[model samples]
Target: MNKKYNIMLLLLLIIISPISYTYNNDFIIRTSVDMKYAFCDVKTNGVSGANNRSSVSRGGIGFGSTSTNSMILMENGENTITIELASLNWFSQDDIPQKERNIFHPNARCEIVVNKMDDQGNIIPLTQLMVKINEDGQPEAYENNKIDSSIEKKIILASNTEKIESDKILERVNAKEYPKDMTVFQFNKKINISDLPKWPWVEADKYEDTPKQRELLQAAYLELWTAFEQQDDSKIKQLLTPSLEVWAASTGGNVEEQFASREIGESFSKQNFQMIPINWNNFQPLIMNNGKMVKLVYKEDFDFSPVSYRFTTEKGTSRVAYHSPIFSFVNGKFIPVI
Candidate 1:
């Protein structure tokens, strides 16, 4: 066999081999509000698992659907792996609050099947390794069996690994191969507001920003940054209106901060500005221009624009000054009006 074939064959055997493991729901599903995606991380064995390991495989559970499709295969032989739900981030239509993105609710159970695959794609399950987290990045394990106040407190205070060891994994077995043709066991539980973290951004719901508004902001935020990074003037123009485009071109400002510029396109091309997505939670809503428009003031951490050739010359500068970009809500979309 050729080198390519040999490599492929080796991988298939190592990941496809089937092995049975005791099903244990030792971990709780934790939701991260800070992430741009609806992300769930796995923690077990006193170790917080990462979602991008080679041993972890991921797939989605559709509504009324009996089987799930496996999209990724992780490294073999590891006892734990984390599966990130890339597809389950807040849907534009789902209307989930932007601040509550980290909260797991009963409205929909985002089921992710993590398969431990051997070289040949055979499988073993490590459900006990699956734990859900609250907004605090802490695990919320199931405590249905015990009602003691102290036990509850202990369970609450117990380390992620400790809480897992004492828990039992309820098996939801199907004859079909999991990930390839797995059965839907259960959806994630809806966490109470009192159970979530006390983050300041969690209160963003008090404002008039609707879920659609936030979703638009998310799309616009990503689009704006991508355009800025690629220096795609046409896309930037498309994202903003004629009035706003002129303003952006004439006035300099980073999405995170504000400043002055003569030509936005020329400034970037000359300085080779690089835009990166760092934080999205550092934003607030404000009414600007005497109620003619609403502005979303994302904190300075949302993205930072810096010169790509800073090493070559100290003269290179970004478009932004000290103030952040103000996205105006116009015609149902956020544009670079400010």
Candidate 2:
């Protein structure tokens, strides 16, 4: 019995010792990305129209996130390395600083990101994606609602970290940006605003016109400027379709209802509040014999200019379209409401 016991003890030691050494003295490791990503949609129930239609999410990355169970094992020769990450702590935009959150800016994301620490403590990256999300109760599923646009999730594979052409990995993922340290974690580039023109709605072309009609187009355009500038809903009303009026009413669509609440301004305070001629396009006639149906677009300056051009000379190049049907031709004017 004593002999058997000795043999069994020796066998156990041989088996357990390897594991102990492997975990304690194997290749060293470190994590570079903020490895937490999980989400939930938030909703509100107080609005009636557009206001009633928005939702702000809360507690996105709830509690009880973990990295221990998810850690991957890396085995190379006699060295055994362990890669681990921490759980995510989530909060609304109001909870964290935007600049800090966007530190890497759009390049850095909430997605999975992987980093590898070499045997010499040198860092390298393997994978990364920002955490993407969906907004709950959004009227438009694919629209750019604050709660809908996902920031994209990032994930990095520490065990996969290699020093070879790091650019290869970036190329494969079409990464937005590359990591500073091949051994450390890296970020992808941020999405370009110009690539997606819907937000500012700036790049679409339409219309051409005869020089004679240019003055008429300009005249009508000036009138439009005055109407909107003076917060004259009636003048604005003359410009809209019957159906549009109903839609506007549904949203309380009067100039006062829209701009007055913001206390934007009452009158022209300057001579050059804005330069709008840049916005008019598709200047041909919308319904005329000489290409008469043209469109005259009237909206706020999306080029990041002030709202009131009321005081400006209102000269230069206006977006007057000759013979445009984009707007109805009321008394030789190119109005877009019809």
Candidate 3:
């Protein structure tokens, strides 16, 4: 009787063991990209919007946001299971200094990491997307806002950092001689008046430049001049916007190639002499029909030091001041349109 009972118990154990094992193995989990890429639709100010909406140009990830996780219900050939995956952190413009922000600022690569559980609390990566993101402008998800118009009203510099109307500032710039001894940043901070072009809903209201716009311009000015002084073609190109045509009328030549040539030429020339930026004194803002659209004029004087002048060596001397290129402010960036 005891042997018979033991045999029956052993049979029951074998049957239950197989059933449990098959239940656990019925479904498998793996990570993959949601070809639909659905999470990129959240829109906020500070990125992209041509139609009067401002977007912060978040490459793809949220600016200053961290990697995140989510779960998706997936179906395999014969089973369905919930899979956990992570959104890996990508690059963001916020990583760079504010003054150095560019269109390709910060973005994360598109990837999905499938996580599997080993121990109750231990998770391991099992699968992931192998594709890399091509960094460029903001992703298409957030590019919906249409900028109402690109036509900006004329910008006029005020004699002082005082609150003044646009017309008053224009009159001031016309009436007074150029201010001296001001740096580019200082020049940008000075009072300026700007107006919106004639809109149907309202007559253009004249107002002092917004604090944010001033700050943006100052940062752009510093970055641009620094890039020029250092003759960094990559940095300069990153900071400026590309023109619509090979020959941009605003810049008077092929924009990218022109800048590249100038920077490269300076590099070769720098072997013999060093050009130092003294100050960016004069500031004039204009609206143009050419690609530059928005324009600012400033005078820059350089100190020329002879590393190996053709003649006898002499102390560094100040080069005559010249007006800078007509820089355009587009999509919150500064580029030499002229």
Residue 4 of candidate 1: its Cα lDDT? 7
**TM-scores, each model vs. reference:** 0.28, 0.23, 0.27
Off by over 4 Å in 2: 1-206, 209-216, 226-265, 268-332, 336-338
RMSD of each: 23.3, 29.6, 29.8
Top candidate (lDDT): 1
* Whole-model Cα lDDT of every candidate shown, in order: 0.29, 0.26, 0.26
Residue-pair clashes, model 3 = 21
lDDT of 3 by residue, 1-338 (tens): 00000111000000001011101121122333332121121100111001100112223332222222111111122211111111211123334443332233234323334544332446666433222223443322211233213211122321222223322212222111222211110000011111211111011122224566545545555664455467555654554433212122211345455445434343325333333342323344433322223334332111111011111123433222122333335434443322
1 or 3, which is superior by lDDT?
Answer: 1
- Candidate 2 vs candidate 3: the TM-score winner is 3
- Backbone collisions counted per model: 44, 70, 21
lDDT of 2 by residue, 25-59 (tens): 32222223232232211100100001100111233
lDDT of 1 by residue, 15-106 (tens): 00021112111112222211222333222211222322111112223232121111111111222222233223222224445554344333
